[model samples]
Every structure is written in C-alpha cells, then in structure tokens.
Target: MKIALTTSGENLEAPLDRRFGRAARFLLYDLKNRTFELIDNAQNLNAAQGAGIQAAETIVRAGADAVVSGHCGPKAFRVLQAAGVAIYNCEAATIAEALELLKDGKLQPAAAADVEGHW
Candidate 1:
C-alpha cells in the first residue's frame, strides 16, 4: 500500500503539517518496498482558494492508496473518497511516528472530513 503523509519537510523525520492543503510537502511511502518519495506542495501552500482540491488531485495523480495527516477538509476528503483513497488522522506527530502508528493499526481511518473548507 502507498501511504501519503502531509509533512513540513522532505523526509520521514519531518514534522507533520496539521493543515493538509497548506502542507509544505507530502511523503509517499510504499509499504511493500519500504521506500519513500517526496511530493512538492508549494503551489497549494500559496493558493488563495481550492488548495484542498488541488492537493487532493496531486495525491491522486501520485497514486496514493491512503493519506495520513492532521486534518482533512471537506473538498479534499470528498475527492479522496471518490477516488477510493482512505484518509487517516495523525495530528501532532512526525511522519515516521505516524507511519508506525498506521502500521500498528492505531491510526483510525477518517469517516468524514474533520474540518471545514478554508480551515
């Protein structure tokens, strides 16, 4: 499974960005091969509107099977859901920590958007 994590930097040790739409970067981790790749999110970070939707599209394009982030807004949540990509909440944790929690089945799949758009 490929899991996408919203982060403040380029690596797994980076802090988790609480806001998915404005995250500085996204780390895509392949569970099968234990490899990771960085996805730049600079455009969405400065977007005046529709950041969530744009970020969601980026993730979809990168082929993420799931997402781990602090919060997911309505627009992004809907896009991901429609694409059959799962979303998980992982607030206040580093990318590495979040992955561990996910692997351990501790992170819960978000049933709905946790925050409103433009949050």
Candidate 2:
C-alpha cells in the first residue's frame, strides 16, 4: 500500500509536519516496493485559503492509498474521503515512526474532520 506522510523534510527521519495542508513536503512511501518520493508543498504553504483542499488533491493525484498526518480539516477530509483515501492521524515524532505505527495497526482511521477549515 502507498502512504503519504506530511513532513518537514524529504526523508523518513524527518519530523512529522503537524499541519497537513501547509506541510513543507509530503513523503509518499510505497510499502510493497519499499520506495519513496518527496513532493514539495511550497505552493500551499502560504495559501490564504483552500490549502487543505489543494493538499488533498495532491495526495489523490499521487495515487496514495492513505494519508498520515497530525490533523485533517473539513474540506480536506471530504476530499480525501470522496477519493477513497483513508486519513489517519498520528502524533509520531518522525515519518518513519508513523509508518511503524501504521504497520502495527496502531493508527486508526479518522472518523471526521479534526480541525475547522481556515476559509
């Protein structure tokens, strides 16, 4: 399965970015292939509105099966849900740790948006 993790850096060791929509980058990891791709999110970092929606679109376009992030806003949540991409909230310190928690089934799918949209 492919998982997209919101992060501040390009590698697995990077600290998890708590803000999903304005995250510095997204590390898309393919578990089966053990490969990863880093996608920069600079464009959305300073977006006045709709950052979450744009971020959700990015994840969908990247073909991610799930998204691991600290929080999900209403607009983003709906977008991801509509696209069939599961959203999991994690407080893990690092991207790699979050992946482990997911692998161990410790991470649970979010039931609803955890944060209000900025717009």
Candidate 3:
C-alpha cells in the first residue's frame, strides 16, 4: 500500500505534522517496496486559503492509497474520500510509529472530516 504521511522532514524518523494542509512535507511510503519518496509541500504551506484542497489533490495525483495525518479538514477530506483514499489519524507520532499502527491495523479510516477548513 502507498501511504502518504504528513511529516516535518523527509525521513521516517521525522515527527508527524499536526496540520495536514500546512504540513511541510509528505513522505510517500510504499509498503510493498519498502521505499520512501519525499514530496515537498511548500506551495500549499503558504496558501492563504484552499490549502487542504490543494494538498488533497497532490496526494491523489501521487497515487496515494491512504493518508496518515494528525488532522484532515473538511474540503480535503471530501476530496480524498471521492478519490477513494483512506484517511487515518496519527497525531503527535513519528512517521515510523504511524506506519506501525497502519501495519497493525490499529489506525481506523476516518468516517468524516475531523476539522473545519483552513484548520
């Protein structure tokens, strides 16, 4: 599975970013190949509005099967859901920890957006 993790840095050891739309980076981890691809989110990070929607579009374009983030805003959440990408909550955790939770099936797919737009 390809899991998109909102992170502060490019590596698995990086701390998870609490804000999905404004996250500094998104580490795309391919479980099947055990590889990581760094995606710089500088554009969305500075957006005055619609950052969440932009970020969601980026994830979808990257072919992410799921997203692991601390929080997902309504617009982004809706976009992800429409794209069939699962959303998982992984606040205050490292990328590695988040992956473990996903592997163990401990992370649940979010049924609804956890936060409002521009959150």
Candidate 4:
C-alpha cells in the first residue's frame, strides 16, 4: 500500500506534521516495496485558500492509497474519499512510528474530517 505521511523532513525519522494541508512535506512510502519518495508541499504551506484541496489533489496524483496524518480537514477528506483513498489518523511523534502502527494494524481509518478547514 502507498501511504502518504505528513512530515516536516525527507526521512521517516522526521516529526509528523499535525496539520495535513500545511505540512512541510509528504513522505510517500510503499509498504510492500519498503521504499519511499518525498514530496514538497511548500507550495501549499502559504496558500491563502484551498490548501486542503490542493494537498489532497497532490496526494491523489502521487497515487497514495491512504494518508496518515494527525488531522484531516473536510475538503481534503472529501477529495480523498472521492478518489477511493483511505485516511488514517496517527499521533505518533515520527513518521517511522506511524508506519509501525500501520504495519501492526493498530492505526484505524478515519470516518470523517477531524478538524475545520484552515486548521
């Protein structure tokens, strides 16, 4: 599965960014292949509006099967849902720990957006 994790750096050890839309970066990790790619989200960091929507589009374009973040907003949640991508909430300190939770089947899919837009 391709899991997109909100992060502040390029590697798995990077701290997880709590805000999905404004996250500094996204780590696209392939669970089966055990490989990863880093996506720059600097463009959306300062977006006056529609950051969530744009971020969601970026994830979709990156072919993420799921997203693991501290929180997801309504707009992003809807876009992801429409694309058949699952959203998971993880408060793990690092991206690596979040990956572990996913591998251990401890992370659960989010049923709805957890925070308001611009959060």
Misplaced by over 4 Å in model 2 are none
- Note the residue pairs that clash in candidate 3: none
Whole-model lDDT per candidate: 0.92, 0.94, 0.91, 0.94
Write the residue-wise lDDT of candidate 2 on 1-119 in tens digits.
89999998989899999888999889999999999999888999889999999999998999999999999999999999999999999999999999999999999999999888872
lDDT of model 2, residue 76: 95
**lDDT tens readout by residue for model 4, 55-108:** 999999999999999999999999999999999999999999999999999999
Q: Best by TM-score, which number?
A: 4
Q: Between prediction 1 and prediction 4, which has the larger lDDT?
A: 4
What's each prediction's TM-score? 0.97, 0.97, 0.97, 0.98
Q: What lDDT is reached at residue 84 by model 3?
A: 99
Off by over 4 Å in 3: none
Residue 55 displacement (Å), model 2: 0.5
What is the per-residue lDDT of model 3 for residues 1-119, given as tens digits with 9 covering 90 to 100?
89999988879999999899899989999999999999889998779999999999998999899999999999999999999999998764799999998999888999999988865
Query: How do the residues 41-61 of candidate 1 rate in per-residue lDDT, one tens digit apiece?
Result: 999878899999999999999
Task: Please give the TM-score that candidate 4 achieves against the real structure.
Answer: 0.98
Cα displacement (Å) at residue 86, model 2: 0.2
RMSD per candidate (Å) reads 0.8, 1.1, 0.8, 0.6
Is 3 or 4 the stronger prediction by lDDT? 4
